[model samples]
Target: MRPLPLSDEDHQMLLKHGKELSDHERRITDLNNKMTDTLKSVDESNKYLREQNNHILEAIIKGNEKNDTHKQEMEVINRQNLWKVVTIAIGSSSVIYLILQQLIHVIH
Candidate 1:
């Protein structure tokens, strides 16, 4: 296809349009850079929050472990007290039985 020749006025209008397009491109590039920087800032904040959350989770786990250990110790103490009470009751019953047997023999 043969190229159409532009008139002088048409050439001037084309130059103005080119300048406007170049300005628009520069603005778009600047906006893209700002958006990338904002994204990076948000990513950094998210990483910090995730680390804090992990720390909190670890602390909670430690506290739970301590509570479990304390509960186990309490159970052992309760068992020991129960055994002591049972032994005392058995000894008292045996002593009473022997005293009753002696009293019956004397009466006879």
Candidate 2:
């Protein structure tokens, strides 16, 4: 095995390289921390969005139920109104026929 002797310039070059590697490592660590923070923020935001979506879905369901109830009530009212109209028409027709019969008998 041969022992290698490093010259002054070579030592200086190695020092420069070492410093650059150290700086790069620090930068990598900083970037990793920033990425971790970003991921945490993203996760929190996703959770919040999920909660909001659930709330909105619940509101929609409740609104739909309310609308169904309203529709049913309206249908009941419409049926009652229809029956009232039919009854009134039948009564009015019977009264008019009686009046005409009486008038015809008097004429005869």
Candidate 3:
């Protein structure tokens, strides 16, 4: 098959268009590379944030456990204090009665 020959001016135009196409291809390739890098950076950030959130949740759970233990200890201490108060009030009433009896005898 015979090849069709292009005139000199047509050849120049074809060469110019090919160069422009190469430039557009290079730009598209660079843009794709940049987009891929950006996605990777975003993925790494997400992972870091997830780790931080996990640590915070774990710390919160530990704090809650400590609070529960403190509450139980406080409840026990309050019960003991209540019993001591009751005992002190009974002893004080007995002493007051004894003193009143002694005063009445002395007056008589």
Candidate 4:
């Protein structure tokens, strides 16, 4: 029906409904803006976290490489020490045998 045919009550009711819808649209727009801002903040946080994790992973890799190098060096040192110990034990035994032999010769 034309606006001219509508009663005052119906016009007022329609105006109130339109105002309510306008208010709802404004609220929806505000909520959308806030959600966009929140999403941007979240994205920034995610990016920062990813960078930190990458740095940590790099450090771990470097540490593992150092550990491997140290292990190899320790193996070489251990082999050298084993040989030194064996040589000392053999030399001491030989000296002891020679001293005992001289003592037996003098006694006889």
Candidate 5:
């Protein structure tokens, strides 16, 4: 079948629709570009947050290590204090015993 010739009004309508379609395409492309920019910004923000989180974790680990060292030192100090108390008690007993023996000898 032979193609029908398009009227002038039909040609005008085709041109208008084409222009609208082109406008729609432009809008769509602009929206796609903005979305891409937004996604990149979000990715950058996430990367920075991850780095900060890692830094915080490292600091916490270091703080824990320091606390453990302090605990060990405290334990050592406590052991030393215990030994000092025992030694003082033993030395006092020895002196008292010696004095009592001397006094009994003199009385006898």
Candidate 6:
């Protein structure tokens, strides 16, 4: 169908409204682009932080393992030392008892 001709005043109004719509569309596009860039930057930052956190956790686990090994070694050393002290105390007591018995027999 053939379109009806617009009057001058109607044409002017339509032009004005078209310009305003174009401006709004451009502003919306700019805002959408900015939002996309911001989201990409945030995603990159999150990825970097996750990698660093994984490294830190691995280091902590290694440190804990080393600590456990040292504790076990110390426990073994302490047990050995305790046994040595007990042996020495028993030997000294036996010798003292023998010496006292011999001295009493000679005096009587």
lDDT of each model, Cα atoms only? Answer: 0.99, 1.00, 0.99, 0.98, 0.99, 0.99
Off by over 4 Å in 6: 102-108
For candidate 1, write residues 10-48 as lDDT tens digits: 999999999999999999999999999999999999999
TM-score of each: 0.74, 0.83, 0.84, 0.86, 0.84, 0.83
Q: What is the C-alpha RMSD of each candidate to the true structure, in Å?
A: 3.3, 2.1, 1.7, 2.0, 2.1, 1.9
lDDT for model 3, on a 0 to 1 scale?
0.99
Relative to the true structure, candidate 6 reaches a TM of 0.83
lDDT of 5 by residue, 1-108 (tens): 998989999999999999999999999999999999999999999999999999999999999999999999999999999999999999999999999999999999
Clash counts for all predictions:
0, 0, 0, 0, 0, 0
Q: Which ten residues in a row have the lowest lDDT in candidate 2?
A: 1-10
Clashing residue pairs found in predicted model 6 = none
Comparing 3 and 6 by TM-score, which wins? 3
lDDT of 6 by residue, 3-101 (tens): 999999999999999999999999999999999999999999999999999999999999999999999999999999999999999999999999999
lDDT of 2 by residue, 6-82 (tens): 99999999999999999999999999999999999999999999999999999999999999999999999999999
| Model 4 TM-score, all chains together | 0.86
lDDT of 3 by residue, 5-84 (tens): 99999999999999999999999999999999999999999999999999999999999999999999999999999999
Worst 10 residues of 6 by lDDT: 88-97
lDDT of 3 at 96: 99
101 Cα displacement, candidate 3 (Å): 1.8
